[model samples]
Target chain A: MSDALYHDAILALAKDRRHAGRLDAPTHSHTSDNPLCGDRVTIDIERASDGTVRRIGHFVRGCVLCQAAAAALAASVEGRGPAAFAAAESALARVLAGQNDPENGVWAAFLPVARHTSRLDCVRLPLVAAKPVFEA
Target chain B: MTQALRSQFPILTPSLAYLDSAATAQMPLAVLDAVRAFETSSRANVKRGVHRLAEAATDAYAAARSDVAAYLGVPPSEIVFTSGCTAALNLVAHSFGALMKPGDAVLLSALEHHSNLVPWQMLAARSGIELRFLDVDAEGRIDLSALETKLDARVKLVSLAHVSNVTGSVLDVASVVATAAKVGARVLLDGAQRAPHGPLDLKTLGVDFYAFGGHKVFAPHGVGVLWARRELLDAMPPFLGGGEMIAQVELAHSTWAAAPAKFEAGTPPIGAAIGLGAACRWLGTLPWAEIAATEARLCQRLLDGLAATPGVRVLGPQSLQARAPVVSFALEGTHPHDICQIMDSAGVALRGGHHCAQPLHKRFDLAGTTRASLALYSDDSDIDAFFAGLSKVRKILL
Candidate 1:
C-alpha cells in the first residue's frame, strides 16, 4: 500500500470509536514501548462466543504509527473467525515487511497502509493483544 | 587554545567535523600510545599475583586512580573506578539506598538524564521513599527559587546533573551544594556532561558524590570515576561483592577492603583506566582558557545562525552566559527526525530526540528537538557547515 492509502485507512478506522467496544469476548492486552522514540501502544483483543475474533482495539499513547497500527488491526479483523483473523494478522505482517500488497482482495481497503512497515506493530498491536484470548 | 590543543589529537586530520564529544571525545595520541605501550610490553591482573607484571599493572592502576583524583581535586582515597558514569551513579543509588527508611524523600532536578534518574526511581519504589522533582524555568534553567522552597529537612539526597544533556544549561553547583548542606542532605552531581567544559574542584563544589564518564573527556569508554567524601565512601556498603574487594572470604563471613577497592569488585578495566589517566594528563597540557574562549565564540555563532533561520526556535537560555556549546532547536512545521535526516544527507551530523530526558522535553511541550553539541575540537568551519546544511533544509521545506 502507498503511504497515503495506509494513512487514510488507519485514520478512517480511528474516526469510528464504536468498533473498539466489542470487548465482552475473552480479552487479552499487552503494551510495547520504544524508548528510542518514546512510542507506546497497548493492544486489546476480543474473541467472540464462536471462538472467532470479534474485534481488535488499541488505546495507544505514542507516535502516528502506533495510532495507525491500532486502527488498521481493528478495521481488518472485525467479525472474522480465528482462521481469517490469523490470515489477516499474517497479511498485516507481510504488508509491513514489504512482502505482500495489502490493497488486494479483502485487504484492498487496507492497501493504502501497506507502505508503512516501520509502524506495522502499531497497526497490529491489537491483534497481539487478542492472541491469548483466541489461543486460550 | 583550540589550534594548539588540536595538534595533540591526530584524529583531527580527517575532514569529519566531530561535534558529538558529549557522546565521546576523540582520544589524544598520548592516551593511544600509553594503551599500546601497556598492551605491547607487559599485561597482568593487579592485586592478584606477586610477579613483576602484576606489580607493574598494579602500579599503573594505582597511578591512574591518583591522577583522576588530582584532576577532579579530590583525595586519591575517595576516587572509586567503575565501568562508566552510569555505573558510578548506580553505585551511589544502590549503596546509599541501604541508609534510607520509609517516607524519606530523594529530590532530583527536572533535567536529569535517565542514567541519573532511573536508579533513584527504582530505589524510591523499593524503599517506599518519596521521589520529588526540582522544577525548571522557561529557559530550562533549574528553578532555584522553587528548589530552595522544595528542599526540606525530610529530603535525604539531592541528585542533579551539573549540566543538562539536552539544553546544555550549567547548574550553579555551589548554590545547589549549599542548599543541600542546609538540609543536611547528601548531594550527588552527575558530571558526565560538565567534566569536559567546566572547571571542577570537589573542595569548592562541596558535593558529597560526583560521577563522570571517561569517554566524555577524550578517554576510552568502560572507565569512569565516582568521587565521594571519604566518610561517605567508608560508611557506604559495597555495591558488588567479588575477588579484589574482599580481604578474606569465608563460607559464612567475609571482610571487605577499603572504599575504592570495595566498590571495584571484579577485574577492572585496567588498560582503559591507564588511557583515561593519560587523557587527563594530555588535557592538562592544553591551554584551557583558549579552548573555552574558542568554544564560546563558536557557540554564539551557531546560536545566532540558527536564530536567523525562519521558523526555528532555539531551546535553553538565549544568552551563552552560563551555558555550554550544545544547542537544540526545532522548526515550526518540521519534525526533529526529518530535520536530522535532511542534515545527515547533507553530511552534517546532529542528534535528534529527547536526548534521554523525557520529562524535560515534556516540560518544553515538544516530542524532540535537533541538537548540535560542540567540544574543544569544533571550529568556525564546523559552524559554517552546519549553517549551510540548515539553509539547504530551509529551502527544501519552504
Candidate 2:
C-alpha cells in the first residue's frame, strides 16, 4: 500500500456520511463554491429549542478532504451548543496556523490533512459554510 | 534511442510518473542547450540589427522560422510566430472573421478545446455571423454525418481541433475538408495536439490555417507557429500593428509588411524560437513509424489496464489507431479530485479537471475526468504505476 495522505478513518468518512443529503425547509442553510477548484458544498441544519443543532445534512460536490470534513463536522456538532462551534473554529484556526496534529477532540480526525498545506480550505470549507448558519 | 529518451529529460526522476504530456511536454536537453548557446553567445535584438552580434541573432531567429516551416512542410514566409496557439487562433478569428459578414456562419465541433471554440464564438458575437456546431458522438469523435448535413452556402468557415485534447480522439480532417469544400467555406485547424505527434505537410493538410504550440512539441513556452496559406495571409488584415510588422509608417496611415511579417507584431520570442527549432530538429531525426508503434503499444496497455479495474470507465475510442496517446476517464463512486489526490500520493502525476474542454465535459455529463497522457518518454513501468495508483483509489474511495 502507498503512504497515502488519507488514512482509513478519513476515507471511511468520505465514503459514507450520515449527513449526505439536503434537508427540506432547513432552519439554516448555505451553499458555497470554492472559486479556485470549482468544488461546491451545501450545509443544512435544524436547530433545537436551546439553539443547538437538532439534525444536519450536507450536499457536497467536492474532493475527499471536503467531504470527509463535512461528515466529521456533522458528526461532531450533534447536540452541542454555540460553545462547541467556537472550539471547532479555534481548532480550524490552529490548522491554518500550521498545526496539523490535534488530539482528543472532534477535529483530531483531520491529523492527516496537514500534508497538502495548500488544501487546508478543502478540509475547512464545510465548517465555514455551516458556522454562519449556527450563529443565527 | 527510445530508451535513451528518458535520460534527456531531467525531470524524469525514477519515482515520478509524469503522465500529463497532453497539457505540456517536458523540455529535452537539446532544446535547453540550444537556448543557452544562443542567449549566452549571441544575445541581441533581431531583424534590424547592423552589428555582428545583432546580425547573428537575426540570422538565428530567421533560421528558427525556417526550421519550423520545414517541420510543417511549409515555406518560411507562410509561417507566423505568435505568443502561443491561442494567440494564433485568435489572430485568425479576428483577421478572417473581419471579412465575414452577417448571415455568414462558421461550423465548429463540440470536441474543440476552448482555444478554438471561444475565439470563433467571440467573432460571431462581435459580428452578426452565425455560429454552428458539428455534432459530437458519445465516444467524443465528431460526427461526419452531421458535417455533411450542416455544410451549406451560408457557412463561411469550418474550425476544429486535429485531435480532441479531452478524449484523445483524432478528427477525420480529410472528410471535414471535403465537406467544407461543398459549401466553399475556408478551414482552420487547431494543431496544438497534432503537431507534437508527427511531421505535418501543409500541402497534404490542404487547410487555410494550422496553429500549434511549440511548448507541446517539447520546446520552451511562449513560441507558437501559425501556418496560413500565403493568399489568405495576404487577404486578411494584420491582427496587430507595430514595428516589425510594418512596411512604411505615416503619421495617420501605415502600410503593412508582407504575409507572415504582417501577422508578427513586436519583437518575437527570441530564445524560445531557437529552442523550438532545436526541438523540431530533434523530433525530425526520430523514426516516427517506430515511435507511433511504441505509443500505440503503451496506449493499449494503459486502456486495457484501466478496463480491468472495477468501477473504472475509459472515455474515447478503445482501438489504439482511433485515438491519440491521451486517456481521459472517470472512476465511478469517486470524484476526480479524490482520485487525483490518492494517486498523487503514490507519485503518479495525472491531470484531473475539465482540461479546458468544458463543453465536451458537459456533453459527457461529467464535471471533469482524470486524464493520463503518454509521450515518447512513457514506458510500461509508468502504466503499471498508474494502474497500481488507481487500484489504491478503488480500495479507498470505492
Candidate 3:
C-alpha cells in the first residue's frame, strides 16, 4: 500500500530536480510553510508581458511528495497563463479530494497521496506557494 | 512478563509496535476501568454541593490528589491538578512569574520543548523580565557547564526539562539544584518525559516545582500534576480565578482559597484527575528496578541498531548511562515524514518532525528527526519490528 505512494515515477520526479532552484530576477516569488511539520516550498516565476509563466523554479525543504509535486507543477506550468495554471491546480485538487480518478493525468503519480489525507497538504504545498503569483 | 504486561493494554495489537510513548502512552485496562467507574457512578461537581454524589466526587478527587502526592513523595495539599503539563507550566509562568520584577531572569535550556520555552517567552513579553537560555552540547544534552555563567542573584528561576523529549537525556538534577540553591533561585522541572519511566521522589530530587501530564503516564488526557513546595505554593498567587477558589465574594473584591484550591478555578477535570491518581496507584505496583533493566536493554539495542544503519545519526546521548528509552535519529538525505510514513506501513508506529523541540533541531542543522520512544509494555518484538521497518524505510525513502 505504501509502495503506491512512493512509486518510481514520483521518486524520479523528485530526484530529477530539473526545476528545483531559484530564477534570477523572477517576476513573482512566494514561499509557504506547513507549520505542522516545518516543511517549506518556495516558488519563483518569471512571467511574460501577457501574464503567462515564461520560466518557473521551485525550492523545497520538505518530504518527497512535496518535492515531487513542486517538480511536476514546475514542469507543467511552462509557457502557461494564469487560467491554465488555475485549471491544472483544480485538476490536482480534484485528485487530492478524491472527486477525480487518480489515473487521470499529470497528477496521477500522487494517487496514493489521496488516501493519506494528512499528506494532502504535502502534495499541495507547492501549488499553494505558486497560487499567489497567478492571483497577483 | 512482557506478554503479561502487554495483555493489560487493550489497544496493543499483536502486529502493532506502538513506539510513540513520549507523545502519549497506551492506557491500561485498570486506568480505563477506574475512569469508567468514576463517570458512571460518582458523577457530580466537587467542592461545593452537599448532596451524596458531590460528597463521593469530592472524596474521590481528594483521594486522587493523595495518590498523586504519594507517588511524588509530597504532601497532598501541595498537588495542583491542571488540564495538562502545558497548562501546569503556564500556571507557574503566570502565577510565580507575577512575583518577578522587570530585568529578573529565568534560565532555561536550548533542549526545552515549546511548552517549557513559550511560557517563559510569554512571561518575558508580559513583564519586562529577561529570558536566558543554556546552550545544548554536541550530543543534545543541556550544557550544565554554562549554568554558572547564566545564573546570578538576578536570576529568580531555573526551569528545564527533566528529560529531553527529543534526546531522552536525563538532566543532572543534583548539579542543577545545587547550583541554583547558591543563587537563591527556584527550579521547575518539566517531568512530562520522566514520569512515565517510573515513580519519582520529587522531594528527594529537590526541585521546587515539577509538572507532568497524565496522558503520557497511561492515564486519561485533560489531567496533569503540578507539585510545588508548600512555601512556594503559598507565596504564589492564584493562576485562574472563579468559583471554588474563593473564600468570600464581594462586589469590589474576593478573598482567595488556600494553595491547591486557589489555583483550581471553577470545576476541574474530575474524572481525568481520578484516572491520574489511579494511574499512580497502578504504577506503584510495578517492580521499577526490573522494568529499568528491560528498558535499558531495549534502549541499548535500539542505539546499536541505529548505529549500524548507514547515514543514521542519533540526536541524543549515544549510551544508556543516564538516558531513557526514547530514541531519535536523523537519516541523511531523507526527510523524517517519509521515513515515518514508510515505517507506518510495516505496522511500526514512529513519530517524526521536531518533537516540539525545534530549537534543538535547528542547532543540529536539520528540519526534523524520526523518534521511537519505549514504554514499560514495549517488548523485543517492538524493537524487531523497528529494525525491520527501518530496512523498508531505507529502501523506500533513502
Candidate 4:
C-alpha cells in the first residue's frame, strides 16, 4: 500500500539497465558482495588517456534499489572522470544521510532512500564499488 | 475453532499478511494472557522457596512442564527445557556427544539449518570425529537411496531437520529411522519448523531426541524443549553445571540432579514456559485435518500463481506431497533481499537470505531466496496479496 520507497523513476532506471553484462579486459573490474543481504555487484571501467571514463560495464544481482543505483551511475559515468566520481560519492553519501548538499549532482534519484534508511546499503554498495576505478 | 483461531492471533489484522511462520509464529491471545497471569499472580522463583507464593509458582511451573510433556506425548521427566532450539541442539551435542569416541562419525543431512549443523560441527571438530552428509535431491528431499552407502558401524548418530527451514520439505523420518537402525545409530529430529504445523506425536516417532523452539509454535520467546528417550537422558552427562542441576554440592565435588533438571541449569524462562504450555493447549483445540487442508489450499494457490508467472521458480517440491506450508522461491535475477523489501513495502511480511541455511543455498547454487511460510491463520487472500506484491517485483526490477 505504501510504495513510497520504490518510485517510478527509480523502477524505470532499474528496468532498462544500461552498461550491463561484463567488460572484457577492462582497465579495472571489481566485484563487491554485500554479505548482509548476499547482494553482489561488479563494476568494470575503461579510462581514456585524458583521465576520463571511456566505457563502463556492470553486473549487478540484487534489489531494485541497488540495481537502480548501479544503472544510474552506469548510464551517465562514461564522460565523467575519477574526479567526478570522487565528488559524487561524497555528495551521494551526504544526500543519503538526509542532508541537502549543492555539490550532490547526478545522485538526486537516490535521495528518496534518505528517508527510508534500511535500503541505504542496498543503494550505496554498488555505487561504492563503481567509484575510483581509475587513477588520477 | 477455525473462526475463533483467527481472532486469537491478535497480530492478524486487516492490512498485514504474515507469511513467515517458519521463523517464529505470532502469539495468540491465549498465550499472551497466560504469560501475563503467571507474571501477575504466580510470580516467584520455582522449587526453592517454601513460602506460599513460591510454592504456587513452583506448582504453576511444574504444571506447565506437565502440559507440554503431555502435548508431546511424553512424561514430564523426559523433556529438558533450554533457552531455545539452538540451546537444545547444543545441549544434545554436548551431553549425547560425550558418549562418542574419536573416529566415530555423526551423520547429518545437507538441508540442515545452521542450528542443527554448527553445534555438531563444533563437537566433531573438538572430539576428532568425522562428519557425513546425506545429499538432498533436485526436488529438495533427502535422497534415501544413497543411505546404504552412507550408513555403517562408524556412523554413531543421524541428525536431520524434520521439515527444512528454507525448502519446507518434510523429511521421511520413518525411512530415516529404519535406515539408521541398521547401523545402530541414534536419530535426532530438529522439529522447530514442525512444531507449529500441527500436533506432533514424538512417542510414536521413537526418535532418541526431538528438538523444537517455543516461539515457533505461538509461544513466547526465550524458551525451547529437548525431548529425549528417558534412558538416553539418564545416561548422558549434564550439559551445564549450575545452581539447579546439582544434587549434593561440596567444595570439592558434587553429584548431578535427574535427567530433566540436570540439563536446565540456573533460573529458566518461567513465564515463557507457561506461555508455551498455553500455546500447546491452544494448538490442541484445532483439528489437524483442518490445519492440513488449509495449508494445502493456501500452498497450492501460491505455488500455482508462482508457477504460471514468468521468471519465477519455486524451490523445493512444487506440489504439496512431501512439503510443509513453508515455501521458498527465487525470481530470475532478483535478489531475495530486494524481493523482501518490495514485499514489505506492500505489507506482505516474508523472510529473505539464506534463512540460516547457507550451505543449502550453496547447494542450490543460489546466494539466497525469498521465503513465505504459512501459519494456520493464513488464508487465500494472504496468498493473493503476496502474489500481487510479487508480480510488481519483476516489473519494478527488470
Candidate 5:
C-alpha cells in the first residue's frame, strides 16, 4: 500500500532543515511546480569559479515526499561538481522507475516511492529544479 | 435503508468507504442498466438516421431529455445537453457573451470553480467587457451584502456557485435573484455540487441559467445539462457550428436550428445522456427529506470527530445548516497529500488538494485541505472509517 511510502527514513530526511531556504546570493537557481497538486520546489546553488558546486539549498512548498527528495538531493550534491549531481539524478531516476538501485546513499529511502506511481513526480521535482543549472 | 441504497451502487464494498463523491459519484445499478440496455438494444446516431434502430435511438434521446427536464422542473425544449458542465458554461459564455458590448460587466464570485471563472475571463479578454467579483465572507459563503455597490445597468450577468465544491457553502439564491433583478442582470449558478443533493425547480429559483455535470449526479461522464430561459436561448447565437446545429447549408451561408439543437453541435454523448435521464428518474423515487436528514446526521458526526481531534481545523462552515455534506479541513504540521496517502491505505477514500478552488484556499491562507464529501449512498460507516483514518494519520504523520 501507499502507507509504506511514508517510512521513518523519508520522514526524517524531510524534517532535515539544514539545506532549507535560499542562498544569500546564489549563482544559479531554478523552480519547478507540480501543476496537479500545486506543489513547488526551488533549488538554489552557489558554484565556485571553477564551476564546481560550493553549496546547495532548496525551498519546498509541497508534500513530505517532495521535501524529502529535495533534502536528499541537496545533501548529496553540496560539495560535488555538476557531473556528480547528474550521476546522482540518474541513479535516483533509475531506482524510481524500478530499473536499478541507488548506488549507496539516503536515496534508498526513496525506494518505496517506486510502487506508488502517482507520487513518482513528487520525488522527482527536486531533480527537475536542479537540471537547468547543468544545462546552462 | 442505507444498506439497500449502498447495495444499489455495485462499486461500494464493505471494506471500502468512499468519501470523494464531490469529485465523481459512483453510478447506481439503475443508471448503469439503462446505459447497457440502450447500447445492447438500440444504439445508433441520433437526429438524422431514418432506419428503425436510428428511430429508436432518436426516440430514446428525446425521452431522456424529457426525463431530465422533468427532474429540473423545466420544459424539455429549454434543456441543452452539452459534453459536460464546463462545456455548458462555455456555451453560455460564448453565445450570450457575444451579445454584450465591450463595456458591459459579468459579476462573478471569488469562490467559483475554474470552470465558472475562467470562461468569463476569456469572455472579458475577447469582448473587452469588464469583469467584477463579489467578495467571499470569512465563512466561505458569497458575501452579497455589498452586492449593491457592484451592480449597475452595465452589469449583464451575475454568475456564482449554487454550492461551493470546496467549502460546501450554499448561496442564498433568493437574495441574489432579488438583488440582481434591480439592475436587470441575469444570474447563472454553477450547480455542479448542488445537483447531486436533491431535485430542483428552476422556475421557482427564478434564475436565468443553471449548469451541472452528469458524472457528479451518478450518471456517465461526458454529459451535462444547461438550462436557460427560452427567450435567452432564442436571442443568443449558436456557440458551435456543425451538422446537427444547422438547418440548411450552402456555399455562402447556412441557417441555424432551434435552441437546444443549436447549442449541441456535432454528435452528442447519446448513451451518457440516456443514462443521466435514467438517473434522474431513479433519484425522483427516493425520499429526499429523509436522505437529507441522514446526510445531516453523518455530517454532524464528521464535524464532531474533526473537532475532537487535537490539531484538526475545519475550513468551511462548522455548522451543518444551509450546507452540503462537504467538509474540508487542515491538520497542523501535516500536508494534505500525506494524509490522503495514509488514509487511502486504511481503506477510506478521501480527496486532498485545492479541489479546483485555488483562490478559496488562498483566501483561507492554506495550500490545500483534505476533503470528505458525501452522497445519498454515504452512511455512518463511511464517517466511522473516515475518523479511523484520521486517527491513523495522527499516529503516523503527527
Candidate 6:
C-alpha cells in the first residue's frame, strides 16, 4: 500500500467503526505501558476454536499515534487464522519500520500505522498479546 | 567587580534571553576556565600525594569545599560533597536508617519531590518507622496547620523541600524548622530547587541538614553538597568507608576521620567541585535582587496570561506572591504531552509530564500538567512568546 492510501485508510478506520471487523468472539485482554509518556494500550484478542486469532481489538489510552495504531491493528487481522496471524505480525513489523508491503501473504491492515515508527509498538499491542496463543 | 565578573563568564551576551536559569543556569566563563585550567595545568590525586601537582590538586579541592560552605552560610566542617542532590538525600536516608530504631516516625510534607520522599520511605520500610505526610492546601502550599497536628514526640525526622519543584511554592523554612524543633526531630531541607534562585543561609534557616545540586546552579554536573550540623555529622556513622575516610585500620578494628572527610570516602569530583565554587562566586556578583524581581515579573505575566486564556487551568497559587517562576497548567480536554509537542513545534520549550512529583498530581487528582519555568534572564518577550504559542496550541488542539 502507498503512504497516502495507508494514511487515508487509517484515518477513515479511526473515524468509522463499521470498517473495524466484527467483535463477535470472546475476548481476553491485557495492557502494556510506555513509561516515558505514561501511554498505555489494552489489547483484546478473540481466538478461534483451534486457538487461531479470529480477531484482534485494542483500546488505546494514549496519544494520537497510539490510537491510530490500535484502530489500524483491529482492522488488519479480522479474518486471519493462526498462519495468517503470523504473516500479519511480520507485516506489522515491516510496516512499523516504514515498509508498506505485506510479507508472507498477509495484507497490510496496519499500513497507516507504519508511517510512524515510534508508535509501532502501540499498533502491535494486539499482535503482541496474541503471540502466546499462536506459540502454544 | 561587575566588569571583571562579566568578562569572566562568556554567556553574558546581549542577544540570548537566558531565562531558563531556574532549570539550569548558564555556566560562567570562570567555571569553564577553572575546569579547563585544572584539566590542563594541574591534574593529580588529592589528599595522598606529596608532590607539587598533587599538593595543588588537594588544595584546590579543599578550597572548593570551603567556598561551598561559605556560599551556603555553613562552616567548612559541615559540608559533605556528594554526587548530586539525589545522592545526598540517599546518604542521609541510609545513614539515618542505620541509627533509627523501630517505632520511630518520619514526617514529610506533601510538596516534597520524589527524591525527598522515596528515601524516607525506604528508611521507614527498613527501620519500621511510621511515615506520615503533611497535606497541602488548594493553593498547593503545604498545610502547616495539618503539619502541627501530625508532628509529635515519636517523629524522629522531618524531610521537606525548601521549594516545591512543581508548584514553585517557597516553603516557610523558619516555621518548619521551629515545628521540628519542638519535637526534637532532625530536619532535612532539599535545596536543589532553591539554591539556584537566591542566597541560602543555613545558620539562620536552622535546618539540621540541607542538600543541593551543582548542575542546577551554573556549575558542572556530578557535584552536590550535603550540609549537616557538626554534632549530627559526628553522631551519624560513616555512609561510605574506603581508603581516605578512615583514620586508622587494624585487623580487629578501624577508626574514621572527622565529619566531612568521613563521608567522602574515595577520590571525589575534583574538577566539578572547583567549577561549582567558581559558579558560586560568579553568582554572588550578579544582581540577585534584580534577578529575583525580573523572574517574579515574568512569572506574574505568565500567570496572568495563562489565567486569561480560555480553557487553561493554572495549577498552583493564582498569584506570584509566594511562588517561584515555575507555572504549571492544564488545558481543557487536552493531554499535556500533546501540548508539549505543539509548543515545541512553536519553538517554545516547556516540560509536560508528572514533573517527577506524581504524589502531588495524585493529591490534586490530575493525570499530568504542562509546566513553563522561568529563570533570571527571562523577560517580557519570553512570556509573550509562550502565551502566543499556547494560544496557537489551544486553537489547534482544542
TM-score for each predicted model, relative to the true structure: 0.81, 0.90, 0.97, 0.89, 0.98, 0.86
Model 1, stretches more than 4 Å misplaced? A1-32, A40-136, B1-4, B7-14, B395-398
Candidate 4 segments exceeding 4 Å error = A12-32, A42-58, A71-93, A114-118, A127-136, B249-254
Candidate 3, after superposition: displacement of residue B100 in Å?
0.5
**How do the residues A34-110 of candidate 6 rate in per-residue lDDT, one tens digit apiece?**
65555566666777777656666665555444555556555556676667656666676676666766352323545
Q: What digit string (tens of lDDT, one per residue) describes model 1 on residues B1-398?
A: 56666777887764556666777888888898988887777588988899999999889999988888878887889999999999999999999887888888899988889998999989988989889898889888888887778788889899999988888899988888888889899989999989988457888888889999998988889999899999988889899999799888999989999878999999999999999888777776677788888889999998888778889888888889889888888888665644554565566677777888899898898777888888888887778778877786665543
Candidate 2 TM-score for chain A: 0.86
lDDT of 1: 0.77
Clashing pairs in 1: A5-A112, A6-A112, A6-A113, A69-A122, A69-A123, A103-A108, A103-A111
**Clash pairs, model 6 backbone:** B9-B29
Which candidate gets the maximum DockQ versus the true structure? 5
Write model 4 residue lDDT over B1-398, tens digit each, in one string: 44567778888897888998888899999999999999999899987899988898889888888989989899999988889999999999998899999999989988999999999999988998889998889988878888879999999899999999988899888898998998999999999999899888997897889999999999999999999999999999999898789998999998999979999899989999989988888888778898789988888888888899888877799889988988899888777877887888778999988888878888998888899999988887788889888877766665
Provide the lDDT at B152 for model 1.
88
Q: What's the ranking of the predictions by TM-score, best on top? A: 5, 3, 2, 4, 6, 1
The reply for model 2, stretches above 4 Å from the true place, is A1-4, A27-38, A44-56, A72-97, A100-136, B249-253
Which should have the higher DockQ, number 4 or number 6? 4
For model 2, the local distance difference test gives 0.84
Per-residue accuracy of model 4 over A33-57 as CA lDDT, tens digit each? 8876677899998888787888888
All candidates' lDDT scores?
0.77, 0.84, 0.92, 0.85, 0.91, 0.74
lDDT of 4 at A106: 56
User: Residue A133, candidate 4: how far off, in angstroms?
Assistant: 8.4
Using Cα atoms, each model's DockQ against the true complex is: 0.14, 0.34, 0.73, 0.41, 0.78, 0.19
DockQ of 3: 0.73
Q: Report the interface RMSD that candidate 1 achieves against the true structure, in angstroms.
A: 5.9
